[model samples]
Target chain A: MRPFLYERADQPEAAVIAARIQGQQQAPPTAAAAQFIAGGTTILDLMKLDVMQPQTLVNVGKLPGTIEMSDQGLRLGASVKMAEAAENEIVKRDFPVIAQALQLAASQQIRNMASLGGNVLQRTRCPYFRDVSYSACNKRNPGSGCSALDGHNRNLAILGTSDKCIASYPGDFAQALIALDAQVETLGPNGGRSLAFADLHKEPGDTPNIETQLQPGELISAFVVPTGAWTRRSLYLKIRDRESYEFALASAAIALDMDGQTVRGSRIALGGVATRPWRAREAEETINGQTLNDETARGAAEAAFRGAKVYSHNAFKVELGRRTLARALLDAGRMEI
Target chain B: MGFSMSQSEKPGGLNRRSFLTATAMGATLPVIQQARAQQAESAPADPRAPVDVKLRINGRDQSLRLDARTTLLDTLREHVGLTGSKKGCDQGQCGACTVLVDGTRVLSCLTLAVMAQGSEITTIEGLASSDGALHPMQQAFIDHDAFQCGYCTPGQIMSAVACVNEGHAGTNDDIREYMSGNLCRCAAYPNIVAAINQAKNEMRKA
Candidate 1:
């Protein structure tokens, strides 16, 4: 890790102001000179790999770290640890999908240390992007060639590829958040604003380096997952090489509001198969007002991976992703909620 | 300062990386070797300056100045002279660097020492009583033979203690899921689970 100055901000406004006093910032917030350190999991990990070299770290862990659940929705403070939210009784009872996603994402140790704000903004697990020795990661270098295109891309994204990059968005909580239509609230020097969770991550188009829609000094303050008809019936299904502690190969976040045997409204987000926390709206549309059967579930799965582009080694992901979603839909259809 | 190390920094037109790349196994070793040499040449080059941090460890308080880049694991093993917490993989993938901050288990390798100023950190060295009686988790590990080489023992023990306290050791499957972060290369997982099972009951009584 490079030598850097660390300052703790007692408040949100102070932290934003401290970050705006940059040293060597880039156009993207990921490469900014000053970064806000909440849990310091992703930032520190990348720094040790020499992938991120921020000159100043403004600790904003003191930002409103609370979890409030009411009839309105689940209001999760950005600085709340993953374990806290995962173990919350209300989240477990009302939003099993959210709790399960958080629980199954990382180890118990990581969950205790990592903050919700930092977890959503976690980077890709692409070896090419992580290992600095590889010179051809478009995500790490703006115009450089993509190494994963020709390298080991079994874990790369297929849903949101733009010929510029294929790195998968390695996260679980974001999938649940997007499926639930969560709203992200952020604090910046200019004040604060709220945006849809889907708008938070940018697809790796020509600019893989610019990962998030967040401004240079903006800090995510909370994630508000509103109560909906589909909230109670939601669940996340992740398929990985192992049973635990591994990134997903293909995962499905499903929230289905059923009218007896027919689907009323549904939200589907695909993880470990896309460049961002992907909302499979086409897949959701295929099942809405339609009977929840094996045929309908299979059709939704087909619609989910309609845009997937497979590489030399990752061709298994498409079929695997399809099967994963089909199984999740069928299983969720049988849920006793 | 944008990721200063790259393939182009190979010193000349014909470098070892290029040679290895032509042979199909090109990278990763040379950079690690180069970094090791850099460390040997100027150990602890505190160019960025140090920050004052007072840490409460076990039951004692220690005031010290550390480079802001120094991790809690490094602070424990180097400055505080507590080598029980090992550094197997400094990047938080391995659990050899696990410790308890504010009675909750965390990867010390990923946590900056300065960030731990206000928290009470407990390492393997702090597990034993002043009268030399080992912690229940430590005793259970010995009884169950939960280690072979024991490189990951300290972190495993620390994590196991937290697992019980966190109510995550309810079942064998739950124990396996919760302890997934800590890797034992010796395949002593079954034994570790047994140890945790034994300790969890003892822990509940206390």
Candidate 2:
């Protein structure tokens, strides 16, 4: 609990205004500076573990227009609780995959307090970053050598990973959003802008510390998922080490549009095995116009894992990833949509 | 001769210590009775800090003050003193902190007190009547003997309410998956399942 100023913003613009003022008046937080607080689920948990030490926590839960839903799809304010979005009648009925992904994620208690925007921005659950006494993490302290690259890379990413970092984005809701082609809306010093949910995450190349495209002093306002008839035909499949409350080893989110027995188009993204939301367009393209079968499924699965490069301890993830994709595809296809 | 000696004898037998003891007991009875009545009549202590909040809980207006970082679970337990909502794993992994905020079962540990300030919060304590009656879910737990150590019973009951509220309690598999957030380390799955079924029966009958 470092001493710092605290302010609550009532409107979205007011939130931006507050951040701008803090950045201007205060010295830049150097491992001891200011940081905006959302649900406090991820940040506070890390703070308790001493993994994150923010001097200032700008409370943004009271900002308006953060939670809303309409015919244009869902508009979740940065403060909207994960439990609220997951249980929205429209979300559950229209986007069952997203609902299921959220519900099956953390326990009911976490989902209740965690927000959709916070879920998207949650840091990697890489064991190295969480253990603070070991300060060899680039994400925790930029330019610090990553101990996870060679040591305990079991839960590390294979795709979009670099020598600087091998941390995986450990969010179930983000995977579902990536598969659904959702967009993230943000408010900053300049104003508001939209970002494709896929592009929201940056590759951990060299600068593993810079995780998202969000600029300094900018706050995520909402995440909107585009409406599609195939939305109801999507599925998120996660395979973890245990039955509950565990991060995934290899997970897949699949959205399918079928014409009779043949596939029309599909959206696929892999989680738990990638540095970002690992979208498999190559695999998706290979499956379109193709009839559903074990052979085609296996081929698409191979395409999904084509560029995967595993470390010493995580070579098993490539095969597991392929199986996860295959199974998710089959599951989506079996849906009687 | 006996009557003449009685006046002096009686006067001498009446000791100062005995007279004082009797007098003290007579004087303390009213004070003791008033203390007991006050103890029984005193309202449950308000645990919430004095922050103006108007939230809905179990379809009723709830007004209270709360700490900024106090988790919804803590607020329900300490502030509102709704102890039916148990705190097992405050880290949100254990479903022991489950409660319904606006009809959806959520983990209360992860939620902030201020965030749920205006939301409809339903805790396990509010599930039953204020007159010492048990909610059907509670009765189901008792009838089925769903809990062993009973530490996770409130969480189990809260999840059961949410399972039905979400309509995911239609089948055994659905109930298992929907109630998956709750964990009873005592391995009370069979009894939990029976309790859920009994609750469904009771709910349908209602």
| Winning candidate number (TM-score) | 1
lDDT of 1: 0.85
Best by lDDT: 1
The C-alpha stretches of model 1 lying farther than 4 A from their native spots are A23-26, A70-72, B1-47
lDDT tens digits, residue span A1-337, model 2:
2233333445555445434433432222223244577667787677667776653455676555444566768776777877777778877777878887887787655675577777888889888998887789988888889989789989889888888999998988888888888888898767889989989888889888778777655788888988786798888899999766678899988888888779888888888999887788889989988997788988999998888889979999999999989998888899975
What is the per-residue lDDT of model 1 for residues B44-142, given as tens digits with 9 covering 90 to 100?
A: 223265667789988889888888889999999999999999999998888999999999999999998878877899999998989999999999999
lDDT of 2 at A192: 87
**Which parts of model 2 are misplaced by more than 4 Å?**
A1-6, A24-38, A62-80, A87-96, A227-232, A243-245, A259-264, B1-69, B72-85, B99-104, B116-127, B204-206
| i-RMSD per candidate, Å | 15.2, 23.8
Q: Find the 10 residues in a row with the least total lDDT in model 1 chain A.
A: A17-26
Query: Per-residue lDDT tens digits of candidate 2, residues B1-206?
Result: 01113223333122223222322343333433343242211111122223455667767776775444566777778877678788887866678878887777777876666556567888776788888788888999999989899998888998897777567789888787667778899989988998898898788777
